[model samples]
Target: MAIDGFTTCLWFDGQAEEAAHHYLSIFKNSQLGHIVRYNEAGPGTPGAVMAVEFVLDGQKFMGLNGGPQFTFSEAVSFQVRCADQEEVDYYWDRLTDGGEEGQCGWLKDKYGVSWQVFPTELLKLVTDADPAKAKRVTEAMYPMHKIDLAALRKAHAGER
Candidate 1:
């Protein structure tokens, strides 16, 4: 079989359809796909969502309304690279609606999904050819709860 992109399967207690709709609204290129329901061979009640396929920014994911046995954690996260500080701030504010914020540009969404909203320029500066500048960028990045591209650039340039 030819292997293409892998679909991330998320197990929810009973909010698969709602979550799918919410995600589709957030991302630019997203839509809900096939929603399979249970008949008799599945777990939980007989008419629940067995699987709901959704596409977010061209990435496909499958949500299963399985009984609550496991949950999402910070171990896995999705990163959104933004062109500027405004873009970063926009996503950060929207994604952390009902979730906690972590250090270094990381935030949890209302669904408990971890997300990293970062500026594209920050990555470029961190990977610059100058090792000392890169080190400065690294140091600046460590103490930040939310990523500030201007601060990172100042640090990279050996400024206060």
Candidate 2:
């Protein structure tokens, strides 16, 4: 059987629709899908959004206006694989607009959503067939706040 893209559900206190719009604006290939509101017999307030389905970069996601019972945590995050340093920098800056930055290319967006904006080349280098090169790449990565591809490449070559 063919498998579609994964769907991630985000729970918001009262801004499911708003958040969906925000996300769609950020991602080039995103758009709002469906808007479902509560009925008299439903769980949420009658006119409030019960859930909003959206697609970001071809990945489906459901945003639920599930009240303020829960919030997002660092444990759950989205990984954006970038082709180069410029792409990595663009996502890293945009995602961390009003949030904190973590080590190793990790960041939390304004909505408290965690994201990992990393270069695709870094993965290949870290998993290189040469054990010494991989070890050097691993060591170089440990001290980084945001990924530096040049530094990583230099590390793999054992250059100062």
Candidate 3:
């Protein structure tokens, strides 16, 4: 496929190929592109995978085996907007396998890449015109590792 927009590059110590495969298995609209290997390059063993390109849900990403000097941090994260609770649960469960859960629907995948997975309604609830309603929804989300859409809706509606 022709990549038209900016492609995200993930820096990995030596798991470029493995990470690409992991993502492929999770996203339905995904496919593997090219696998670039080192050729006589002194930095890595010849024929070893240097980088892997893949598409996840139409977004292009490249996994680079750039060594251990660089690592993924919370400074940057990808957000997954789910249509409903089931979508949120699917991503949260898969991405958090052998990984960590952060407050407010944030998580670090097994590869250390941070992600924000939540229902699409969250944006609407948190930004509601009614300040109190929005505040309640935001408060309810504060302590959650995986967002619960029903709970958030109840908070927005001022329900006990």
Query: Evaluated with lDDT, which candidate comes out highest?
Result: 3
Against the true structure, candidate 3 has what lDDT?
A: 0.95
lDDT string, candidate 1, 1-160, tens digits: 8998799998887888888997787777888899999888756667777789999988999988876788888899999999899889888887887778899999888888889999989888999999999999999998897899999989999999
lDDT of 3 by residue, 25-111 (tens): 998899999999999955899999999999999999999999999999999999999999999999999999999999999999999
* Worst lDDT 10-window in candidate 3: 36-45
Backbone clashes in each candidate structure, one number apiece? 0, 0, 0
**Relative to the unseen true structure, what is the C-alpha lDDT of residue 158 in candidate 2, on a scale of 0 to 100?**
97
Model 1 has an lDDT value of: 0.88
Assess candidate 1 and give its TM-score to the true structure: 0.90
Worst 10 residues of 1 by lDDT: 41-50
> Can you give the lDDT of residue 61 in candidate 1?
96
Best by TM-score: 3
Candidate 3 residues lying further than 4 Å off, grouped into runs, are: 1-4
Task: Name the lDDT value of residue 9 in candidate 1.
Answer: 91
Per-residue lDDT for 107-158 in model 2, tens only? 8887788899899999999999999999999999988978999999999999
